[model samples]
Target: MAPKVLIVLSSHDHFPANGKPTGWYLPEFAHPYHVLKDKAELVIASPKGGEAPLDPNSVEMFKNDPVSADFLQNSQELWKNTVKLADVLPKVNEFDAVFYVGGHGPMYDLHYDPTSLALIQSFSEAKKPVSAVCHGPTVFLRATSASGQPLLTNASAVTGFSNVEEDQAGLTSLMPYMLEDELVRVTGGQYVKADQPWGEKVVVSKTSNGAVLITGQNPASATGVGQEILKALGVN
Candidate 1:
């Protein structure tokens, strides 16, 4: 049997400040799903479980994409039946890797969810691959190593939504804190980015202290992040 990957998505669907609906970005999940579905067994889970919200904007972004079509056409209820994150943490050893999909929703929940912190820490301590993209990196804010040191303290390079992009999106004031600056200034990780907005930039590196991590800058980098995960899993 192929290795199993657990996909953890944020269930917080409301944008607190403006009360706008927000959830996982479709492309981030679809693109990676297409890449890993054939190579590994995937289990979808969420903080709250059951019908995790899909960001309204991502619906239009993926309207014409085949992977998106597969997602929309999926009648399996895989996404609809997402298990709770709290339940999965204890069985972390059953999964070969764990992937956190992104959306602004994570800023509201996963960033501070205790179960999320445990899941990430569980994967890291097992020396298994832990991947995230865009706002998904927010989970790292609470991830720590077995020794209780910052898990990303030795990461060579990590990328996520940059401050410039957030500023360009005109959501700076709306967000609790800028994801980019929080990762760089607060988390103390070496955050970097692509030159152009929405450009595809995937960074795969082993932390100086030895941990396999793969991160993507934005939605466009989703597939590449999956490819990196395959590599980390020793899949061709």
Candidate 2:
């Protein structure tokens, strides 16, 4: 049997401006899902049990690409069968890994969520690979390891959607807070950036205990992020 992997996505569906639909970026969820599904039994979950919003910009011709467009059309069916985060009775030992997929929505909903925080802590304590990409890292801002230390405090290597990308997307003024900067500040984690915004892939840092925490810079990094997670899990 393939290992089980839990994939968490944001539930928020409204963009600040005019209540436009926005949630997980299509590619971020699609690319990773395809890769992982090939080798694992993937479970999709969100804070709420319903349709996950897709960023409008991510559906544009340039952004949709082939794979993402296919995923978007099928996402509803996929999510309709997803396990709600509220309903997840994690054993912490049943799953091989956890991955957080992100869009601007996660910045608002998942960041301070108590349940999401608890899931991360539980998975980390169990020594499962804890992975995130794009704004997904926001979930870690409030998560703590089993030892009572902030999960990311002193975590030297980490990455996330950069301020530059937020600025370029014209959403810096709209978001409640800056994700990359705030994460670095609160956790005191040594945050790093790519040469250009949205151009780089995921970064994985192995803890001394062999647990892996991985992050991606933007949608461009989604596939690489999934690959890293598979590698960490020792899946082909």
Candidate 3:
């Protein structure tokens, strides 16, 4: 059977800091979706269920990118008919992996959502791959293992939306906390980044217990993150 992957999206439609419109980033989801669509069975889900919003700025910024544009046109139903995250938590064993798609939106909701955190813990306990790209990794900021230890404590290396990238975007002050800084502090400097800002960077960290954590630095690293997930799942 094909590996089943749960694709988690943020249901938040706006940034709490300023009430500005924000949702999952287009390319972050689109690029990774295309990469895994052929090899895995994917189920879309979110915190609040129903239609998950897309970041308007990301849609506009990546409109010219063919893969993202095509996904926007053809994959609307996927995001629109999302299953409630809490409902899926009980069925965590049904999936082989869990992937978090990033946008500024997750920083508001999934960042602290207990249900989402629990699901990540479940996946980790099951030895299934837990992966995210860009701001999506923010959800891991609070996730813990079944043993009550910080989930990141086991990660030897990880990467996410970096402090430099956040500053470059000029939206650092608006975020509740800097992702890179917190990740570094949590993982004891396990956080990694690309050589330059906005460059593609994907890190695969395997915990001592054999749990896999795959992370990407930014939207540009989404595809690479997806590919790493497939490899982790033993998919050719």
Better of 2 and 3 by lDDT: 3
Name the TM-score of candidate 3: 0.98
Query: Which residue pairs overlap in candidate 2's backbone?
Result: none
- How well does candidate 1 score on lDDT at residue 156? 79
TM-score of each: 0.95, 0.92, 0.98
Clashing pairs in 1: none
In terms of TM-score, which candidate is stronger, 1 or 3?
A: 3
**1-236: candidate 3 lDDT, tens digit per residue:** 99999999999998777888999999999999999999999999999999999999998999999999999999899999999998999999899999999999898899999999999999988899999999999888888878778888879898999888889888987888999999999899999999999999999997434689999999999999999999999999
Cα error of candidate 1 at position 202, Å? 0.6
* True-structure lDDT of candidate 3: 0.92
Give the whole-model CA lDDT for all candidates, comma-separated. 0.86, 0.81, 0.92
Candidate 3 or 2, higher TM-score:
3
Question: What lDDT is reached at residue 18 by model 2?
Answer: 61
Please give, for residues 151-199, the per-residue lDDT of candidate 1 as tens digits.
7788878889988888887778889988888778644668889989999
Which ten-residue region of model 2 has the weakest summed lDDT? Answer: 201-210
